[model samples]
Target: MDLLHHFPHARQRPLRELLAEKQTWVNQDKKGFLRYRALLNELRHIRATWLDLNSDVVHIGRPSDLSPADRVHLQAALCSLKPWRKGPFSVFGIEIDAEWRSERKWNRLIPELPDLSGKIVADIGSNNGYYMFRMAFHHPTLVLGFEPYVHHYYTFNLLNSFAGLSNLQNTLLGIEHLSLFPESFDVIFCMGILYHRPSPIESLQALHVALKPGGSIIVESQAIPGEEPVALFPEHTYAKVPGTWFVPTATCLQHWMQRAGFHNIRCFCAHEMSSEEQRQTPWMEFESFQDFIDKDNPGLTIEGYPAPRRVFFAANKN
Candidate 1:
């Protein structure tokens, strides 16, 4: 829970002050997330001496190179955290086929990103630090990921330790808590989480406050395809995922960004999600995107809302 000690010398004081302000909440979270204490202890047994950082696969180590006993131990420790939703990692010898083909998302987002060399970055709603690992390839000064879920937070820390990365840090915090710092980050990535918030505009405002002047934000969100600036407010659920509030078009998102004090907004790419991009895999044995869409008409969700399409936006704070 003492996080600032992990930071570099220059960042320690500011981060330490922030943590001191939130010490009580952090203590409660430490207790809440440490429920998987046994599995976490077992994870300490994994050791990876080899690494490939720049590649799309992000190979940790070869499984065949490990003894049979060690390989089994590695798999057991990883599988203990089931329903893995964000990766397709090759750790040691086992291939963890996660629910989302995150590599594809990485490829799509990378081309749109500015050069991140030596920049401080924040990834909001970072599920298991998939993108944070990818962002590390750019030699960013630091990559901080905020994930509220306890399981995903632990999973990211476990994977980061396996990767032996010093530049990336994952914390068990929510995007709403970005208010703790002002003008702290150079780039903020808020992906696939806008529709979940009842007040997406306020969330964007918080992101603006967190960024340095002229800092850019990369927003990836679920959208209902259209040229008009409109948003869908589902009565209850969208795509069978509860808590979904709004699915806006690309134009609507641009407008929202402008209203939230961002300028020079650009809709880089908007694509419909394919079934291959998300499906139940060995690591995640649960319902996936396909299950939420209507089988009779692939263009609509079970609730008869528009099918899932995603849009990426790049905007700057002025």
Candidate 2:
């Protein structure tokens, strides 16, 4: 937890201090908060399971290195951390098939982003640091991930400890906290988060402020198919899921970027989310996209809104 070691200039306003300021809200008596912390600490106590860092599956340990008892212990520990929403990780030879096939998003966005090698990157709304770890593959100088949810934050640490990724740091913070950051990042990745914000424009502005001058940003979000510039503002929920505010068209998203003071905005790719891309697995056994989609017509949600088609847009801070 040495924040200063990674960010030497943060002595004036350290990440630990920021988290301390929000201690009351973060440590509120939310369900499973204490248990999640306990599990994370317990995981840290476990002996390091040696593994490779640069692999497609995020290999954590060789199967032959562990005894039968060790494998069982590792599986039990990992299972305690349920509903892993953002990964498809291989830890200690056990495949934690997460809810979302994140690799698909990575595959789409990587081609659209600038080379991350030696770049200081930040992943806003980093769920369990999945994309952050993937970003490390490009050999970034440093990777900082911000996740507000305590459970996901702890999970990120547990995985980082197991993976031994010294270059990556996952902090318990949110996009709102980005205002406290200096204009330091070379690149920022914002995915599956814009629609969740009540003020998407302001969120983009915060991102714009956080980036170094001439830095780049990658935005990926659900899109309502259309050519005209428009965004769908759902009343309460879209696809029976809450907190989904505005699903914008690609053109609409470009306009938001332009409004946020970003130049060279480009909506590079848009693709429909598939069942195979997000489904119930051993690690995350819950309602999935199939349940939310219109059974009679797969092109729309059960509520008759357009189905989830994600789009990626890249822009530069001018």
Worst 10 residues of 1 by lDDT: 1-10
Which 10 consecutive positions of candidate 2 have the poorest summed lDDT? 3-12
* Candidate number achieving the greatest TM-score relative to the actual structure: 2
Alpha-carbon TM-score of each model against the true structure: 0.90, 0.91
**CA displacement after TM-score superposition, residue 118 of candidate 2 (Å):** 2.3
Off by over 4 Å in 1: 1-35, 64-67
Encode model 2's per-residue lDDT on 77-170: one tens digit a residue.
Answer: 7888788998778887788889998877887776787889998889999988878878887899889888878778878887877777788987
lDDT of each: 0.82, 0.82
lDDT tens digits, residue span 1-318, model 1: 444432332245555665565544544646564555555666665668877666666677766557787677778778888888987777885778888988888888777797789998899999888789888888998888888777887788778777878888877667887776578888999999999999999999989988888898999999997889999999988988889998999999899999999998998888998779999888888888889999999999989988979999988988
